[model samples]
Target: MANARKKKRADIPARDRILEAATRLFTQRPFDEISAEDIAREAGVAHGLTFHYFGSKAKLYEEISQAAADRLDRIHLQATLAGSAPEKLRSFLVAHMEEVHRRRVDYVFHSRGGGTAAIQDIWERSRSHGIRLVLGFYGVTAPSLELAVATRAWLGYFDELVLAWVQGQITNKAAIVEMAFRLFPVAVANAELLGEKNLPSV
Candidate 1:
């Protein structure tokens, strides 16, 4: 069965096969742990094909990381465009969990601050989008510095719960989302204490 799959992968266009194989390997291990040769073997292509398509291993990893971030961004944008605030927040959380589970090891690595600067930058950008989405959900378009700081801190708490859930320590996703829904207003209230006021509810 594995051999048949390998042969089938070999039939894919060389560049795409390499990308697919690299993505699979990346989901299983960090960038520094995977060599171009490993990708070439997994893709059933000449070792030089990865270089031909991407120039270097770092470049290939960058493309894969960027691609994953782009996908999550699309999911986030779609959620924003088509639902009530609670529905959008729930939808985004569920979709985010699905993506994290699909790439569990990769998500865990980056969640634990285990990546190069470039890779971490991509992770940060994704988190920034998430923070903005949560702010939008709460009807905050122009956040003050206090509100922004509070929101970022709230997301850090949210991220920790998500990381635990993905790592199998927490089992009930609904509970996590509900916790976020409940805690968000409190977080904003704290921001109010620091001088921002009249924050809307989730």
Candidate 2:
């Protein structure tokens, strides 16, 4: 049983290695430019193993994209929940900027594929989840349709700022954050409007 468990642990690394290689390739190059053979060569595994594990290049790309999205969501959720609303907003913005810097290649790939059906579906799912999370942070028990529209508008502004920053249109992170803060007075006003009984002082 010990030997079997050890072997199971051993196989995990190979699977992770494949995923890591695939992620690197997908982010660094266009999807059409990356092939299963390239992933297998980079992973130092047999070509057939790529198919054995991921079935196809498209599936592998989808899996890697989903993994990245899941990781970002987890980070955002944790940071938001671990602090007061103001701190949460600050942390979320910083975290998001850091993540965009770290994952620029992934961002480029998604942005460049804007009109692709697969990318559109992924964006829709991610956007829906993001909207729900933002509503939770605002502490709106029953947000009206107008509130939803406002939230989406605010989120779009934030996203555009981050994109601009990432693309070199904005030079300073602190300045960008400050601008975002100026535009996002809702974070402060929401605490009062929601009647959060024990709101922390910003």
lDDT of 1 at 21: 93
Model 2: weakest 10-residue lDDT segment is 193-202
Q: Which regions of candidate 2 deviate over 4 angstroms?
A: 1-14, 112-116, 186-202
Best-fitting candidate, scored by lDDT: 1
For model 1, how does the per-residue alpha-carbon lDDT over 1-202 read when each residue is reduced to its tens digit?
9999867766789999899999999998866788999999998889998999999897888788889998988887776677788778777777777777788888887777776678889978887878777788768777788888888888788778888998889999899888876787788889888787766675
| TM value for model 2 | 0.75
> In every candidate, how many clashes are there?
0, 0
Clashing pairs in 1: none
* Number of the top-ranking candidate, with TM-score as the measure: 1
Model 2 has an lDDT value of 0.71
Q: Name the runs in model 1 displaced over 4 angstroms.
A: 1-12
Candidate 2, residues 1-202: lDDT per residue as tens digits?
9999767655776668789999887767667787788998888778898888878887777788878877778777776887766677777778777877777766766855633576657766776666666566657545555555555666677777777877788778898777776666565345545454433233
